[model samples]
Target chain A: MSHKIGFEGYKHENNVGFFGKENSKDGKDGKEGKDDICPVATQVHHLIELY
Target chain B: MILVLGQCSDQVIGAFMHHCVKHSVDFAFVDLNQLGKSIDMDELYWFFPGQSPVSHSDITGVYNRFLDWPKQNKYQMDRLLSLFDWLDHRYENVINRPKDTMSNLSKPYQLDIASQFFSWSIPKTNIIMNTQIKIKSPFICKSISSERSIVNQVYRQEEKAFYEPALLQAYIPGLNIRVHACDDVIVAVGIQSDAVDYRYSRFENDIFMYHLPGQVEKDILALNRTLGLRFSGVDLIYHNKKYYFLEANPSPGYAYFESQLSRPYISEALVSSLSRSIH
Candidate 1:
């Protein structure tokens, strides 16, 4: 059985607005606003072996 | 009544519609593209066509999977935006509120929110112009939005000619794990692909189901809560015995997994969750 372990978290440099300006105030700086709504995220997961 | 908002041909919505039929649930699908053609909205009325015109009060819950905007004249587009804005504000039991989706319009934005609660680290990412920047080789580049292709290597001769801003991440080698969480239920799968972008791989037949460890499951739930998403598909890479965080997808295509794995109960879980929200 594979066990999970927590890794040391690293602080990312705040690179807000590195991309162009978001069209709305909510999408600005990649910050969550009170209004921005998204649906549930689902996808197919595929893995490839490197060895 | 449940309203499913998405493209007419989306397989995910097709699966959801299948489940609704199996249970004899009353549901309707409103094609995202066709909305602008016939949607009639006034302070006193809301109209969308399916089998018949559906009114605002008739809808109890919404499962929104809309992705692309349809081609329309500028006046039509403006009108559709206004109508969408009204629906975004009026609906409360939607699978995802439209406003929240707007905030997560880009991968970097989603990563910023995921970093707040995830136990793992995200790759060092920079969104830069096609102009050369000093970065290690073997990094991956993708569009900030889902509208573009994902390419490996920071400096691809083909992509270098295109002058557009793109997101570049330090590539990590490891196994890919995708976790689908709906409400409190979590289903995880391991994917094995030979291509750098697994979605484009020809060896899709190699994909298989996977189980996640207990701690990792807990972290995923927390991450979903932080994003205010009750349903999500989370991507993680297990590298060097540690998991690295990838972006969280709001509208994930689950038909691939549904066809591959039997244990996750993807469509059933979604139906049950949505059903509960109605009552």
Candidate 2:
């Protein structure tokens, strides 16, 4: 009931899709959707490791 | 053939399909959400209007309207992007390959590059990972990767309300607005949201309007060029009469605004732009 359009809720409305955190199997202490806010960083690191 | 991703019946998807048909262009629809299993690449090589993926290799171009890719498997996302990359490289003659369309869809990357000019209003946002969600008493938190509507929450004066790691920002008291920034023209919708929540105002009765500032128009356009975003739906918040930059949607749902306003301004503009790009 208190749900709000995150974009409208916060100023970063476009970031709605990128905020989801899929934590690793480490559970609660594991990662959240770190890629949500900045997937570019992870993507870059992934790409470099690929090379 | 141009492939319009997503389901065919959806209004916006249908519009894109209809536009291709009206222009007598070759196109196919790839329902990634409907795609069943670990299929081979050949299954979706070519898209036939009024038809599903086929074994044919004559697929010349693609409109690249695949939004559901992110939701699909990494292979799914790569498969769709790969097709576009191939189409652009192999048959540039078949696909639009227009700069405007590309920029329009990459709103995030575009905004990243355009932030320099609009740094004042835009939030001091950082794309961080694993950094425990930091809050400043009454702060804002949202998942940047969310897809649903109104599922994002705003914490009010709570230190550890949800305890979930999310986007934390300094909550600003202002007007929330979405600006329809196509390649040529820019239009915006303003909402008077509760100084704190406002994001959830969709369910609550609130004041909203369509507005444009004389000064911001030029800068928005310039920022568009800087970001290489041909067409984008950007969120702009106005607090104390000064505008602030929120975010941008490269492939926004124009239908929502058009239906809510009972007008097809943005939708029609998008259709027209797509047609011109193909021609």
Top-scoring candidate (TM-score): 1
User: For residues A1-51, could you state the per-residue lDDT of candidate 1 as single tens digits?
Assistant: 211000000001122221112212232212211111233233345885658
Deviation of model 1 at B180, angstroms:
1.6
The TM-score of chain B in candidate 1 is 0.83
Off by over 4 Å in 1: A1-51, B36-55, B73-79, B152-163
Candidate 1 Cα RMSD (Å): 15.6
TM-score of 2: 0.59
Task: List ranges where model 2 is wrong by over 4 Å.
Answer: A1-51, B1-3, B8-11, B14-28, B33-63, B70-81, B86-112, B118-120, B124-137, B144-153, B161-165, B192-209, B277-279
Measured against the true structure, the TM-scores of the candidates, in listed sequence, are 0.72, 0.59
For residues B219-274, write the lDDT of model 2, one tens digit per residue.
77776666555566666777786777766555554443443444446655654554
lDDT of each: 0.61, 0.47
Q: What lDDT tens digits, residue by residue, belong to model 2 across residues A1-51?
A: 211111121213112221112212222210221111111111223334344
